[model samples]
Target: MDDTANDDLDVAAFTTAIEDFNRFYIRLPTLEKLPFTTLSVLDTLAYGDGPMRLTDLARTEQITQPGVTQLVTRLEREGLVERRPDPGDGRVVLVHITEAGRRICRSRHADRTGHLIPLVARLAPEERQAIAEALPALTRLAELGRDRGRAAR
Candidate 1:
């Protein structure tokens, strides 16, 4: 085939594969049970080194500042988070995850792993090997994207 035809085929194949992977991943029992936004916010807080500012949370979550505040309020009401004044800046309220939040996060992570492990085990050996070989590059791609996202904000 000509170079143009080859390029078009490559692009289509790449796009389809990404979409398929996302579809399969989001359909997993663990993810399907949680609201995407709640999981996103909880995951962010669980992974962060410390409390985050409301504005930063909004930016990270790609939502409005008020939206994040509202979400935080709801989380606080549910005992999943607590807001405290930043020692460095009394005016800045930092959102921190509560013990309940941490517990839920650990539970969710375990659930996802438990659900995925069986699926991975069921895959043919060759298919599992192929995925393991691709993992490093895929992980690198995710890291690059995360870096770019941080830089953008």
Candidate 2:
């Protein structure tokens, strides 16, 4: 195939693989333990620096400000999150994950790893090696997407 043809094929394959992964990843039985939305917010908070402003959380989750407030309220009531005054601005309150939230997030991560480890272990050595090698690129792809989101905002 010509260089252009090969490039087109590569793009098609990459896009399809990403689409399939996105569609199938959340459907894993281990991940279904909590409502996806709840887990999503928790995971976001877990990965963020300290407390996050409510507005920032809404933007990050692609939800309305009020919607995020409701979600945060629910999480807070569940003892998964807490509201704190942003030290820099008393008017600006930030949402932070509680210790319970950290524990839950860690448990969920471990569950996910446990689920995937056996599956990966079953793969051929070369296939497993390929996935291991792809990890850094996949992480970079995620970072690029996040950077694009910040730029858009």
Candidate 1 at 40: error in angstroms?
Answer: 0.9
Using lDDT as the measure, which candidate wins?
2
Q: Candidate 1 local accuracy as lDDT?
A: 0.82
Off by over 4 Å in 1: 1-12, 31-34, 48-50
For model 2, what is the C-alpha lDDT against the true structure?
0.84
For candidate 1, give the lDDT of residue 57: 86
Each prediction's TM-score versus the true structure: 0.79, 0.86
The residue ranges of model 2 lying beyond 4 angstroms of the native Cα positions read: 1-9
For the record, the alpha-carbon RMSD of candidate 2 to the native fold, in angstroms, is 3.3
Candidate 1 lDDT over residue span 39-71, tens digit each = 788878888545888888898899998889888
Q: Compared with the true structure, what per-residue lDDT tens digits does model 2 show for residues 54-152?
A: 888889888999999999999999999999998999999989999999998888778778878888889999999998898998999888987786676
Candidate 2 residue pairs in clash (backbone atoms < 3 Å): none
